[model samples]
Target: MNQQWRLDDGQQTLVLAARSGRLPECVYWGAPLPVTEDLVALHAAYALDVTGGMLDENPDLSLCPQSARSFPGQPGLVLRCTDEIRMLYGLCFVDAQQNGPDLRLSYRDAAAGIDLTFSFTTDPQTHVITCQTTLNTDRPVQVDWLAAPVLPAPQLSDEMIDVSGRWCGEFQLIRTPWSAGLRMREARTGRSGHEHFPGLIVPNRGTTNCQGEAYAFHYGWSGGHRMLAEELPDGRRQVQFGHATNTQAAGTQFQTAPLYITYSNTGLNGCAVAFQRHVRDRIVTDAHPVRPVHYNCWEAVYFDHKLPELQDIATRAAALGAERFVLDDGWFGLRDDDTSSLGDWTVDARKYPHGLTPLIDHIHSLGMSFGLWFEPEMVNESSALYRAHPDWVLGPMDQIRGRQQLVLNMASADVRDYLYDRIAAILSAYDIGYIKWDHNRLLPAPDAAQTHGTYALLDRLRADFPQVEIETCASGGGRIDFGILKHTQRVWLSDSNDALERLRIQHDAALFLPASVTGSHVGPRHCHTSGRTIDISMRAWVAAQRHMGFEMDPRELTDHEAKVLTDVTAWWKANRDWMMRADILRLDSADPAVIAEQQLAQCGSRFVVFAGKAATSAQIQPRPMRLTGLDPAATYCINVINRDHTPGLSRGNPALKSGPLTLSGAYLMHHGVTLPWHFPETMWVLEGTRK
Candidate 1:
C-alpha cells in the first residue's frame, strides 16, 4: 500500500509518497500539477518504476524514502543504541498531520524505542520550502549522519553551478556535468571559509540568465555544512543539504538546520530573485534604519591613532558626505600591529590619555557616527587575558598559533562570560554606534558547541544594546550565510578592494544576498591585494550599488576625485531606499565583457540599472541592454545618474536621443537603450521613473 501527499503555494507544488509503511519519499517536486487521490495512478502516469526485474527475490531493492529509512546507500539516519546495536531497522509510519502551510510526518521503531519526525513548510509568498528532521530516542543513541531537506531533481538537470575561491577572490562560479554518482561540496573548516559558499545552483544545459529551468538550495547555517548532489542509477537525482555532524550523543533529541530549496522555470535569475525575496520578507525584518555611507581609518592611517590626526581625517570624511567613521584595529591595549594585544578591550592609555571620549566626541560633532573594530573571539599570547587564563584558549598547552592569535574556547561558560562583560563594558563607557566584528582564524576541529556559543554571545549583545549595528567580518568574506545574518546587519564581501575584481564578486554574491547587506568599499588607487590602480570614478560607481563605504583616506584624493566622491554619495543617498526594497534582476548579454544588473521597485514606479565593462573587446559597436521587471503599459523617463563619468556621451546612439529619453516600458524592455563604446574600467548608471 502507498500513501501520497502534496503541498502547493499557488506558484509551485511538492508531492511526496510513502510505500509499505515508511517515511515519505519525494514523488514529484516542481511546478504545480492537478490534484488527485490516486497516487498509484499518478506514478504510473509518469512511468516511474522503483521495482527492478527481480522484485520478488529482492523485496528491499526498491527506491525507498532516503530521508529517514533503512536504505543501504547513504542512510539519512545512522543510529547506535545503548545496547551496542548500530542499526535502526523495522521502522514504520505512525501518523501525518497538516496545519495551514506546515506538514508534519511521524515515524517510530517500537523495538528500538526511537521516534523520528520530519517537517515541511512552505512560504506562501516566495514559494520557498524549508525542510528539517528531528530524532528522539528513549534510550541513548549515537548519531553519526543525518540529512535534511533531501530534494529530488528532475532527470533533465545535467549541469551544476556553485562558487569556490580563496581569500582575495571569493564567489568564483564553477560549473560541471552532473553524472551518475554522488558529488558533495563541504565546508569543514569550522567556519564558512572563503571557499565553497553555502549555496548551490543546478540548471539544465544551456541555461542562461533569463531563460531555461533552474533549481537553487542555500543552507541557513554558519558552521560546517555539506551540500550533496547525487544521481542514482535509476536516472533520479537528489540534492541534500545539512549541517556536518560527527559522532555525538543524541542526548534526548537532535534537530538539523533548516535547508531551503526553490525552483524556477524562467532561468537562474528567477531562482535568484526567489531567494532575495525570501530573505527580505522572512529572514531579516528589522533592517537598519539608515544605510549610511561609511569610512574606515584602516588603510588611511594604520595603527597610528593620534587624536589630532584622526580628527583631521574625520573632518575630511564628513566633508565628503560620509555619515559613519570607523576606527579600525589599533585603539586597544599595547597594539600597534596584528601581533599583540587582541583580548584586551581597554583603550590604550599612551595613544589616548583621556580615553576615547575626545575622539568620539569630535566624530559626533562632525555629524558622523563612530564605529570601532574588535576581534573578540581571539587572544594573543602576549595579552593580559591569556596570561590570566591560559586554559581559555583551545588546542594544546603549547598551541600552534594562527595569525599570531589563538581561538578563545567559546564553549566554556567562563570564557563566554568574560568576553560578554568586556564587550558590555565598552558599550557602556562609550557612545559607539557600530562594531566591526572581526574573526581572524578558523576553529581547530568540528565543534558545533563553539558555533552555538558564538551565537549566544551575539544574541546577548543584541539584547543588551539593541541600537548598535554589527558587521560580521571573518578575515574577509569568510563568514557569510543566513545564520550569521540573523545577528549582523551587513557583511564584508571581500578584503580585496580592486574595483574590477569586485565587479565579479559583488555580482555573484548578490545571487542570494541583497545589495544592502553586502559591504563594498572604495579602496586606494592601487589596491593592496590586486596591486591594480583603478580610477576613482570606476571604483565609486561599483560601490554605489552596495552598502557604500570607503577604505581609503579622503585626504589623499585630488580635486577631481573629491568631486566624484561627492556625486556618488549624493546619488546613493537618493536611491538607496528603492535599492533596498527592489527586486534584483541580472540581464543576459551576448558579450562576456559586459555585465548588467537592475533593481526594480515593487510598485514598478522606479528602477536603477548599472552596466559595467569588465574588458575591452575588438567590436566597436556596443550592445543594446534590455531592461526587465517594469510596468508594461506605463511610460518611463530615463536619465543618466553618472552622466559626467560616462565617456562618449556626446556620440549619441539611435536608441538614446538628445534630452531626457521617454519611452513605454514595453518598448524599453523589448528594444533596449544602446550604450556608447566605452573603454575597460568604465561603468554607467541609468535612473528611470514612471511618467
Candidate 2:
C-alpha cells in the first residue's frame, strides 16, 4: 500500500527517524515512567479510542510545553525539546463501519509515530482530515504543523494566491516556542521568526512571486486545540480556522485549535492539518446555532427615515423581545445605501436630529442592546474625509471615474489612528455594545495596495475597545473567516438572504466555523435580492435554530406571522444554553433535495433535534443516525417535537425511543431512528442512553 500522498522529491527523500518498541533504557529514559511529562511543557495532544477504533474519546493523551527557545543564524532550524510530548490523530469515515479504519499519531519529544489500523474500504480514495492546535498553552512550544511541501517556485506573492491557481510553500521555525507569542510574525527585510506560528514560512527565491505550485492544508493539534497552517488560493496564508476566507485579499480567516488541556497530567504535543481540496467561487464557515437574532434598518430607512421612525422600529422589536437593535448604514457619514454617504463619520443632521444620542438612549430605555453600522474603509467623492485627504483613498491619485468612490488606505498608520478615533468617539458617546462594521466593496486593487495598515488597525481596535463586539461584513459573505472572528463577536454570513439558498450555503459554512460565531438571520419572505416570497414560519424556524435575526420591515409582517416571530423569539430566549454548548450532529441526504437535521446533546444526555425543510414522506428513516458524544450506558427519555405536519404524528410525542442503543456500524451506520413523517418541520427532544 502506498502511504505517500502528493509527495515531491524533497519530501520523498526526507528521512523519518527509526523507532524501536524498546527505547535506550536509562534511569531518566525508559519504556514507562512513574512521573509523566509535565502538562505545562506540552503544545498539543489527542486521545485515541482504540477500543472503538475511532477518536470517539481521548482522555489519556498528554503534552509538555515550555517557553519558546530560539537560536540565531539558523535556516530550517529545529528546536531541541527537553520536554516529551504525544499527539493522537484519528479518522472515521461517515460511511465506514464503527470498527473501520482509525489513524492515530503519537508525537513525543522530537519523534513522531503513526498507528493506522482500521477496515479500509474496497475503493481507494484518500480523504484528508485536519485539526488546528490552540497556541495558548501554559508553557510555550514552537512549531509549525501545516508544512506545505515546497515546490520549485519563486517567492510567494499576494498575487499567486490572489486568484485560482495551485500553490506550494513551506513553514520553518528556529526558536524556543515559549519565547514567542500566539500570532505568527513575518518580516519583509529580516529572516528572524519569519516562519513562526500562524505565519507561512516558505522557501524563498529572493523574489516576490511563486512558481505557481503549492500544497494546501497541513496542521497539528496543539494547545488543547487543533491548528492548521496553509497558504490558500486567495492570496491569504490562513493560520488555524479563525479567519477562513477566499475573498480578494480583503482580510484573512485565522484560527488555531481549542485551548485548555483535556486532562491535567498528560505530557504530549500534537498539531492538526486541514484542506479544502475542491474549488468553489467562495469559501464560507458553517452555520452556528443560536446566533443572536438581530434587527437592522437598511432597506427601510436608506438615509431618509427619521429618528422617530427608527425609534419606533427598535422599540417594537424590543417589545417583541429581540436581542439586538442594529441601526444600519446611513446612520453614519453623509452616505446612505451603496453610494453617497461613505467615509464621512458625522451623523446626518437632517435624518438624525440631536445626533445618535436620542436614538441610542431610546434603544437602551427598552432594555435591549444597540448596534450602529459603519463603513470606515470606503469613501465617496462628495464626502468630507475624501476631500480633506485625497491621498488616503486607494485608487490612482489622479484617476477619476463618473461614479467616484475610493477605498480607504487601511495600511497607513495615520488612517488607522483616525478611523480608530472616529469609532472610539462615537462608541463613547453612547453606551453601545455592538458595531456592525461593514465593508461594501472588495479591495479595489486586488494586491492590497492601500497604505492603511489593515491588521494593525484591526488589532488596535480589539486591544483598545475590548468591550465592543464587532460583526465583520463584506458586501455580504465575501469576508467570513477565522482571522476576523478572533476580534469580532459575530459575522454576517452572506448577502444571499433566500432561505432555500441558505440551506446549502449554511451547510458549507459550518464545516469550518462553530455555530456560535455565525450570523444567520430570519429575513422577510420577500427577499430584497430575489424578489421571492417564502413562508415566514419556515424561514423563522430554520433561522431561529441558528444565530439569527430579522432583515425585513417588521411592520410588513402580518399579525399571524408577527405572533410566530414573537413566539419563536421567546423560545430562543428560554432554550439558548442547549443550543450553545452541545455537540452538533448533521444528517446528510444525496437526492438534490433539502433535508437537514441537527441534534444537540445537552448535559451529555438530553438532546434536541431540529429537522428543517424535508420533503414530504410517510416515514422519514435517516440512515445510521448514531448520536455523537454520549454516554452509552445511561438511559435517556427521548422526546420528538414535530413543528410541521406529517400524516401520523403530532407535536411533542413523549414515547419516541432510541440509542443507549449502542453506536455500531460506520458513523452513518450508527444508531438512528425512523421518524413517521417530514417537511418544513422541527422534531426535537430526542433522548436516550449511550449503550
Candidate 3:
C-alpha cells in the first residue's frame, strides 16, 4: 500500500516508489528535497529490514526487477518464446502520467502479455535527467533483456568510474571496486566499442573532480550496450542499462536507450556541467554555431594524393589559423590504404582528376570550411559497393573482415536506399561543409538493426543537409555516445595523435566530454600514434584543449613549429566564443604530475587554467594548482597565459613567472596555482578575469 512520485529540476531530486501497485523504484535520488518532502514517509523511509536470510518480503528493488518477485538482481525483464522461457510475473501498476516535464509510468504483465512503460524527464537547463523503458508484447517475444529504468546504487559508492577504451586509447577511466556481486559491462563490438564506452560514474565516498557526491549514467545506445552495477544480496543496489543481452530480433516492440541520468552536488564537475550542458544545449544538431578552426588532410597526404599537395596544405592550414579543412582517408574509392575504397561514395576519380572542385576551390580560398571523409558503415570487398551488394553484407557470409570491410546491411531498406543515393551524391557534389563520419571496423555481429540503420542514415542526412556538419569518427574514441551525439557534430577524441596521450585523453574525457564535443588535435612532431616526441609547446597547448585541430603535417611545421602553431591558433581564435561555453573543471591535483583543467566562464566572469605536467613530480617544487568554479568573493585577474611555456630547468622566481596575480577566489580555490618549475612535457596557460 504505497505510491509516491517526485521529479524536480534545479540541480536534482527524483524520488519514485511503489508497493502494492508494484514495479516502480528509484526511491530518492539526491539533493533537493522539501517542496514539503514526505513521499509517503519517503517510501517508508526507503525500506530495508528483514535481515537474517532476508526475504520476509523485501523484493521491491522494483522498476522492473522481477522474477516472480523473489527479486535478486540483474533481472529487469529478460523474456523468451520460441518454445518457452518467459517470466514477467505480476507486474502490476497500470498508469501514472504527467507529460510536461515528462513522468509517464505504466506497467502490466497481465499474466505475461507484458506492457511496461516508464518515461521520466527533467532538464531545468541541463541539470539532466532522462530515463526510458518500454515493452509491449501480447504475442511475439524474444527481448532477452530490457532495462533502462532501474536506478538506485549509491550505498555511498565505494567506487565505479567505468568507460574503458582501446584503439588509440579512447576515454580510459576505469576505477571499479564497490564489491559483493555483479559489476558487468558489455558492449559486444557493434559501434560504441573501442571496448565499451557507454558511460557511468558513481563517486560518493569523498568524490572529487573538485568536490563531492556524484552519480552519472549515460547509455544512449549506439548498438549493443549492457552496464549493470548491482550489489544486493540484501545490501540493496542496482544500476542496469540495456540492449546487449540478446541483441533482440524476435519482438513486438522493445525499447531502452535514453538513460542519461545525472546528480552531483558540485563535484565530478556537477556531472560535468550536466553532461556538458546537455550536450551543448540539448543534444547537438546541424551544428556550426561557431566552432571551426580545424584542419585534417589525414596526417598529410596519407594515400599520397596531391592536388598541389592539398593546395600547399591548404595554404599552410590557412596560415596556421585553419577554420576547417578535413578531407581525410584518401578522398575515396580505389582508395590507396585502409584496404581499398570503402563503400565507394565516389569522388576519387583517380585521386581527383579535377573533381573535388580543385579541393573545394582551394578550401574556399582559404577562408576554410570543407570537411569530407566517410566510411558509412563499411563495405570494401575490393569496392564498387562490395561488388554490387554481396547480399548487402551484414553478419555472416563467412564473416571475419574488419579493416578489409563488410557490415553494410544497415538493416537494409535496400541498403538504406543504396547508401542514401551514394551519400546524397557526395552531399550534392562538394563545397561540403563537414563530415568525418568514419567507423573503421569491429562488428561482425551485434546489430540493433545496425544502430537503427545508422540512425536512418544520420537521420536522412540530417533532413537533407540542413547545412551539413557531421563528425563522429569511430576508429577514434570508437563511436562516442549520447547515441552518436544524436547524429553528429564532432568527436574524434583519439586515434593517438599523442600529445602526451592527448593530455590524458583530454583529462579523462572531462568526465563525460565537453570542450564543445571534444576533438582536440595537433599531431606530428613525430607522433604518428605515440612515437611520442611532443613539443610544439606540448603540441600546441594540447591542441588548445579541445575542438581545436590540425592533424599534423602543416608542412611539418618548425619555424619554431610555425610560431608555436601560430600562437596556439591565435589563442584558440581569441577564446573561442567564451571557450566554447566553458565549465570543464576537473582539478584537484597536488601533483600526480598534474593534469589540470578549469574552463569556467558561463557568466562566472571568465576563467581558463590548463596546468598539465604529465610526469615526474613526486614532490619537487610545483604544486598548488587547484581551482574550480570560482567566486568565493571574487577578485581574480590571474594571468600567466603561457609565460612562454617556461623551461630551462627552473631559475626560480615563481610568482607564476612574475606578473598579474590578484588572487582570491578563496585564494585560487583553497590556495593553488603556483606552478613554475617546468619540464616533462609542460603546458601551463592561465587567464582569469573578474577583478
| Top-scoring candidate (lDDT) | 3
Candidate 2 vs 3: which has more lDDT: 3
Q: Candidate 2's residue-wise lDDT over 258-349, tens digit each? A: 21101001100000001111101012222223345677777556566688788888877776668678888776665545567577777777
- Say what the RMSD of model 1 is: 2.6
Model 1, 367-418: lDDT tens per residue? 9999999898899999999999988987776756788999998889899899
lDDT score of residue 246 within candidate 1: 72
lDDT of 3 by residue, 248-367 (tens): 788788888899899998888899889988988888866887798888878877888888888898988889888788888877777888787788888778778778898788789878
Q: Cα RMSD to native, each candidate?
A: 2.6, 16.3, 17.4
- Estimate candidate 3's alpha-carbon lDDT, on a 0 to 1 scale: 0.83
Estimate TM-scores for all models: 0.94, 0.58, 0.41
lDDT of each: 0.80, 0.43, 0.83
Clashes of 3: 2
